[model samples]
Target: MFANIIILILVLLALIFSISKWRIHPFIALILSAIVLGTTLGLGGESTISVVLQGFSETLKWIAVIIILGAFIGEVLRETGGAFRISNRIVKWVGEKKLPWAMGFTGYIVSIPVFVDVAYILLQPVVESLSFKSKRPVLYLGLSLAAGLTVAHTLIPPTPGPLAVASLLGVEMGRMLIINLIVATFAMIGGILWVIFFLKNSWIDYDKKLQDIYKEEQTTTHNELPKGNWLLDIMPIIVPIVLISTGSFVTDNLSGWVGDALGFMSIPLIAVYIGAFIAVFQIAKKDKKNKVNRLVEQAITKSALVIMITGAGGALGFVIKASGIQNEIVQIFSDFPFLGAMLPFVVAAILTTATGSITVSLVGTASMLGPIIDNFPMSPEIVAAIIGCGAFCVFHVNSSFFWLLNRLHEVPPKVLYKTFTAQSLIMGLSGLIGVLILVLFGV
Candidate 1:
């Protein structure tokens, strides 16, 4: 058992090294690590191969369609000017003095369907505009935006990171959403407030190049298609959540075919599928059928890589289970009661800090720890929150989001370390605190 633990540790290190230092694609590294783990741990060739295939297919079966639907919705929103419309109206409603708060909430909404980097890209102009109008430091609003995106990216479903983590941990989407939203609120508010207080009087300069690009973006914005109505724009985001949650809660209240029908309608796949068509309807209302067709194609194309990577992460997870190492660790953790609560968080933080990718961090840590963690006494929601918070903490040099924010303005990396990094750390810890509070209440 001790020997198996050492093997597990070594393979994990190798996996990290391959991604961080060797630049191996994560899909490839994960697959290779699974085989190596199964082989060294006495599963032998055939058994390991079976476990690999089993893991990949099983994991994908649960989430592949949901992911595709999610990607489809995100693509439609991106192409249809839906996200822009939502945020634009938000900007008007909140007005200038509240721009930081507005940008933060806009980020929280837009990023639910959109990737964090892509959300940042879609909203950057608005964030910049908000900062200028409000007369606030760029770092202030920028960090607020980052804060929202980071929280949703790590904690919310259908944005990939938390979605995949939820599936790997055997968590239902409804439960994940309910618990994570509460925890994410804590994170988002903490980040927004930190930046609000800290950078209130600070002045930061953008690089000349970024400043010129900003000026260019404002004047030459696209005008080819109509933006979705800000009111109708949120349908795609809300439909799935309402359906899934209703399915979770209402199935118990109603019985017979009616209940079953509602349950079927609420299943994530059907709900998201319906949401995609709602997105199509949005495009149809604009008389852009051709655009509608193209968006579906784009969603199919884009979801392919995410699906493959998620499947590979699953394969590695299954192989870890097959190796007996997971059981070994579970027993060891049994002796250290607190390990149950903190292990997932620590694993996630280490991987995110190492790889600079929250998706990878969430996937890798969840895949490895999910099965073993079932042996722990923590609730699934608490585990998910812990992982989400861990993934957000220590957002320093290794992260792409850090660099994205750095390039947004002329803020030196050193200064960002003090500002943006500091904000993420506070938000992450706040999330952890929120989870502990839930645990105290016996959630």
Candidate 2:
């Protein structure tokens, strides 16, 4: 048992070193780690290969379509200017005095489907405009908006990080969404309050390069496409979640034709398909042949690598479970009860902080810990949320998002450390607090 545990740890270390230091592709690293783990465990070659194949296929079958559909919806939302319109409208509705809160909510909604970086780029112009109009600090709005987007991007399903984590840990998507949303709200508030209290007086003076880019973006006119209806534009992302949740809740509680239909609608795959259909419908007849088709193709192409990495992680997890090391690891964790619950979160934070990629952090940590995941006292849903929360904490120089914040907002490194990093820390700790509360309440 000790030998198996040591072998597993070595394999995980190799995986991390390959991805973080050697710059090897994660898919390759994960595959190699699984192979090494199997060899060390004395699994026969045929069994090892079979387990890898089965795990990869199973995970891809369950998650690939959902990921591609999410990417497709995000592509449509980006191209339609719907995301921009939503943020802009929100800012106006809330008025400038509450700009940080409004931007935070805007990011929260926009990030439901879109990648956080892409969402930031799409909404940057509007946020800049608001900053200029209101005479508020750019850092204030930027930090708040980023906090909201970062939480949802990391916590919510179909955004990749949380989706992959939930899938790896065997957490149901409906439950993950419900619980993560609730916990993430608390984290988001922590970040917002940090911005409000600590960064209330902060501002960033635009540099020449940023000024020129801003001017260019402001001058460019968008092409004449169908103007997107705000609700219609957002429906593809929101409706599916509603349907899936309803299906999850209603299926067992109610019986009859109504129950059957709702239950069927709630299946995540079907629900996402319905959402994708709505999103696809948004492309106008004039643009469908040329633009919409291309966008869908692009989305699929883009999602391929993410799908591969997730599938590979699943393979590694299968090997771990098949090796019978899970029970040994679980028993070891049982010796420390609090550490058992917090282990996933700590692992996720360290990986994210080290690699600067939340997706990588989630896949790596979840795969490494997945075999013993059931041993955690907390429900799988809450455990998944803890992982998501940890993945978002400790945003710093190694992270691409940190560089994006630094470059776009032109905040100095020192200021970013004080503000952005500080806020992420607050949000992360607050998420942990929420999870602890739930644990105590026996939820």
Candidate 3:
């Protein structure tokens, strides 16, 4: 047991060391780590190879199609101006007085389909323009946007990170999505408050230079795609959310073929496929339906790397199970179930802070910590939410998102630390408070 404990610790350290120090891609690092873990634990070469392959294939069976479909939805939204429409509509609805909040909300919605970094880049001009014109600091607006994106990017299903976590942990997608959304709301609210009251008054309060930067580009880009229909714009995102969430909640209450039908429709893969199919209609009419093939190819191309990484992460989890170490670890936590509950979050947070990739963090944490996770104190789905919350933490030099925040927002390191980094830490800690609050309510 002691030897297995040491082996687990060493495997984790090596994984992190390779990712952060050596800067190996996570897909490769995970595969190598799984191989090492399997063999070191006496699975031997043949069994280790078999476990690795089985893990990879099984993991992808859950997420590959969903992720591919999601990528398609995002690409369609991006190309057809749906993302732009959503942001613009939110800004108009919230009005200028609440521009920061609007930016945050826009980010939350858009990020459900779009990648966080990509979403930020797409919305950067709007954030800058609104902040400068409203005489608000870019930090206030940008941090709010970042906060929303981070929450959705990690917590929401079909976004890859949380979806992968749920898959590796054997969590039900619908239940995890519902709980994660609630926890994410808590984090979002906490972030908005921080930006409004505190960071809004900070030294880098306003900048006029940003006004000139996006002026020409915004006009040219806005002209490229007409304003999309509001309902049409939101369909790709809302369809799956409605279907999966409703199915999870209502299917069990129904009976006979009706219940069976809802259960089948609610499957994440099918639900997301419906959304992606709807997104195809958004392709420009002038180019005809034939252009969709191009978009499909693009979506597949974009999602391929994500699918690979997810598969590798799955292999790592399978290897961990094969190690026989989980039984020993489970024994250690048998007397303290709450501590066991918190383990996923802690592990995920550490890995995220180290790797600067929440996808890798959640995947690594779930694969390694999943066996003993045994439905946790409440439910594995809730634990999945907790893991999502934990992975949302302090981002700094190591993170590409950190550099993007600095570069795009043009905030000095001091301001970046006080604002973006600080907000992320608050979100993670406040998210823990949310989990505790939910647990108290018998979640």
Model 2, which residues run further than 4 Å from truth? 207-226
Q: List candidate 1 stretches off by more than 4 Å.
A: 207-227, 284-287
How well does model 2 score by local distance difference test?
0.81
What are the runs in model 3 whose C-alpha is more than 4 Å off? Answer: 202-206, 211-225
Candidates' lDDT values, in order?
0.81, 0.81, 0.83
**For residues 123-229, what per-residue lDDT tens digits would candidate 1 score against the true structure?**
77666655654556777778888888889888987777887888888887787788898899998988988987888976765633445445533532323227447
| Candidates arranged by lDDT, highest first | 3, 2, 1
Q: What lDDT is obtained when candidate 1 is compared to the true structure?
A: 0.81
lDDT of 3 at 239: 91
lDDT of 3 by residue, 277-370 (tens): 8887777788766678777788889889888988999999999988778888877877897788788778888898888888888888889877
lDDT of 1 at 3: 88
User: What's the CA RMSD of model 1 in angstroms?
Assistant: 2.7
What's the TM-score of every candidate structure? 0.93, 0.93, 0.94
> Lowest summed lDDT over 10 consecutive residues: which window, candidate 3?
216-225
Evaluated against the true structure, the overall lDDT of model 3 is 0.83
lDDT of 3 at 317: 92
Q: What's the distance in Å from true for residue 276, model 3?
A: 1.1
Residue 115 error, candidate 2, Å: 1.1
lDDT of 2 at 206: 66
Residue 163 deviation, candidate 1, in Å?
Answer: 1.9
